[model samples]
Target: MSMKTRTVKVGPVMMGGGWPVSIQTMWKSPLAAFSGPGDPSLLAAADEIRRLAALGCDVLRFAVPDETGADSLGALAAASPIPLVADIHFDWRLALRCMDYPIAKIRVNPGNIGARWKVAEVVAKAKDKGVSLRIGVNAGSLPEDLRGMEDRAAACVAAAEREVAAFEELGFQDVVVSMKMNEPGEVERANRLFAAKYDYPLHLGVTEAGPLIAGIARNTAALVPLLKDGIGATIRVSLSDSMESEVIAGREIVACAGIKKAGVRIVSCPRCGRDSFDTHAFLARWSGRLYALKDTLEVAIMGCVVNGPGEARHADIGITGAGDFVLIFIKGEIARRAPLEEADKAFAEELDRLLG
Candidate 1:
């Protein structure tokens, strides 16, 4: 079901036109308070952006509510290695200001961005700057006329259609559309509807998706089917949890859909009564680092011998516990042994050797 779509380049990455579907996450911090190139907050954000990019987030978005947000995000975008998107609502001026920097895209709700001319203003700037736009149509905020429609999914698609028309009318076609709803079914229905009619690349997501467990469940349910259908060009698993969780979950969802399958896959066992190694603690400590690796490898973090060497024999690297010793193995062969206290350091060294 991998279909061709019009490609939109965002800085170093390209979306659609049979390109690999990208993973994205919103920056959780508020940038309005930080201003200028010298601000420490922006520097910290830049460092975090690098870390997120390393963790497989292809694009990063920040909410630009006012001029101050635009000011800070502009400075940060100048230094960011990966492309940055300015999520602007209401004010088209902020989009203009954000475009003053190297921001790659602007996300706007046609309903919120006001008149057709306002959108045109943004679109004109977007075209001039070689920037892209995402027509963000959320279920919570359909048009005034469409609000009374019984079918929420149809209303979302209609809103997106209207926005897409608005952009094309202005002769600006570098567009991506998203029709998000809290319910996974509604989101999927809207995206499927839009994908059937339009060639614009879609930014797939479920909005206001709850915390870690609920968010991943909802986003996965909605995105997987759409990805397999070749309906999405990029995906963001919006969550009430950390941004890292969102990016990691997005990667897993894309892989699960069989759309794209190149990343560090973790095969960790859930500890039980016979558990020895603390799988939970180890995974928490190493998850980010493992995910940041560029190699396509399976790393198994198991609790005991039963779940480790024998069960995860195909894994590129693995660790488990037996009686009084923690064992590190490569492809089912025990390569290093350490006491429980020294497992972390020993596993780190073994992982380096394995990856090398």
Candidate 2:
């Protein structure tokens, strides 16, 4: 059963309350990259934001290091195609400054933002503006007392609970909570514990999960179980890669966990000695484009036809090498053939036809 937690609205996107799991990614470049004197930088950032949205990134977050960064975020938020989230650290004032803009959400740990009143001030402003707030609690940034706990996952939970209590005290409930740890086991345990204790929607992720492959593996291992139990509302695959890569990884993880039922699905076999087609190169070229498609497509890029057609027979469309030529099959039946050199072009034509 899906965990029906409290729903928080970030602009037009709704998370929890049985909504589909949303994918988020943080902006890698500093806010200053788009905070130049003219509109050029902001326009460039807007283009990047649109591209991420096309790749299925539901929420885009940026770290607000200072007041200037907050101002930059406001400018970007005005033109962003998707909802923007301001990630604030020790300064509650930054969060308040961010609220002055069109930002949809503010992310900060109540414990780290100085005194309780500071948190209250930000919370009050967020409430008045109808903006949601995410209480982020990372294992590495826990309070001093919580850091000495024997169980790190429990420590994460405790920190989050305290922040949630502060929000509750002000009767502010437009909140979401996240507790991330670099270790996959701790991440899973923390999310499970939090889900059991509160109905506040949980944002799932594994912090500092390294590069593309390693990050995907760690986040998948940690998130699959929690998502399977319907514990997460929004997810971000925190990869040390491009924001686009993170969003794509999050989508695939959601699909693999069976938490999502719609979107393009790609199935390709691992190449072996009998392989004729360069499956690796073909996938690397088409993965992003294929995933960006809105239609429900089951595309299979197989190595050889020996078992390719039979193996991916259930696929809507497939391509594989058959000796000297490439074969494009539809529903297990060969639909078209092309020479090795022209395979990509032929596949593109067929793909366009299918998409059309």
Candidate 3:
């Protein structure tokens, strides 16, 4: 459970050590078409960013495919409420351009960015601008030198170390490292290997984690253990779902792992034969209202009264289904009962009162 203490500055953000794990989401908009010289795409990105910001994203990343796309940085940085990170694949010039603005961070793998001096130049520019760089290493795009290695974890670690070493050599220590894989087990193993050796901030995520359910499961599998052991600094839930959903899932992961402080965690039991009312629909109906609350709360929605109260004793608020009625419990006390028809509004009103 040894984690490196190396801290990195992502714009004004300081990650690693005791820093809370941040939730980040990527933009789905066209990187190439999102901007222009004077007609900056910042305003366009603003609308999308507002949505993501409302979902509580800690950082937002957009791909800088080319130079024209880089112009969007100013508007995004100017109007964006959260830190902005530029994702650069091979172009060192785009990396430089990203550093030119108040960009918070850059995701670039020195191993693939080409030429030693180019890497140094980018690193130097980032250092000069006081911008943090995330040395992103992915299993899908491992270095050719490590292509034949039977152990992907070793290769992943080597790749990360190579970039970290390069950044360290440039007298720049503001670096966060990630070793991402589609397989949860591989991602965990590689991160485990890295955590054992270095103290640099580790960004945890499962790359290309499929559609919603599978992606959440995979990300949960990889993160739970590391998080419990105090291993991760920032996290991203990469799913083929909406960016807001991904951000929500990321926050949930942190909450479930007990690494983050968020409002209102609703613990609902899986409906079984004994459940009364429609537990599934009841939960689905009230979940959004709970999500809308400004303050964080720990809530439980149980299927039946049999074990509902006992199981929900730890939650700040609880609800148990009984026939066509729902018993709303606050702090383990039965507060009121509402019919199935009025359950949604009733719960929303109660939660609003509870939050207020």
lDDT of 1 by residue, 1-356 (tens): 23588988888888888888989999997885664677887788889999999999999999998888888888888999899999988888899899898899989987787777888888888899899889999888777888899999999998998888878888988888899999999999988888888888889999999989999999999999999888898999999999899999999999999865577999999999888889899998999889999999888888887767775577888888776778888987889889999989999999888878
Structural similarity to truth (TM-score) of each candidate: 0.97, 0.96, 0.88
Give the better candidate number (1 or 3) by lDDT: 1
**Sorted by lDDT, highest first, which candidate order results?**
2, 1, 3
Q: Pick the candidate with the highest lDDT.
A: 2
Candidate 2, lDDT over the whole model: 0.89
Candidate achieving the largest TM-score: 1
- Candidate number with the higher lDDT (2 or 3): 2
**Weakest lDDT window of 10 consecutive positions for candidate 3:** 31-40
Candidate 1 lDDT trough over 10 residues, lowest sum: 29-38
Least lDDT summed over 10 consecutive residues: which range in candidate 2?
Answer: 30-39
Off by over 4 Å in 1: 33-35
lDDT (tens digit, per residue) of candidate 2 on 108-157:
97657868889999999998999999999988888888888989999999
Global local distance difference test of model 1:
0.88
Full ranking by TM-score: 1, 2, 3
Overall local distance difference test of candidate 3:
0.80
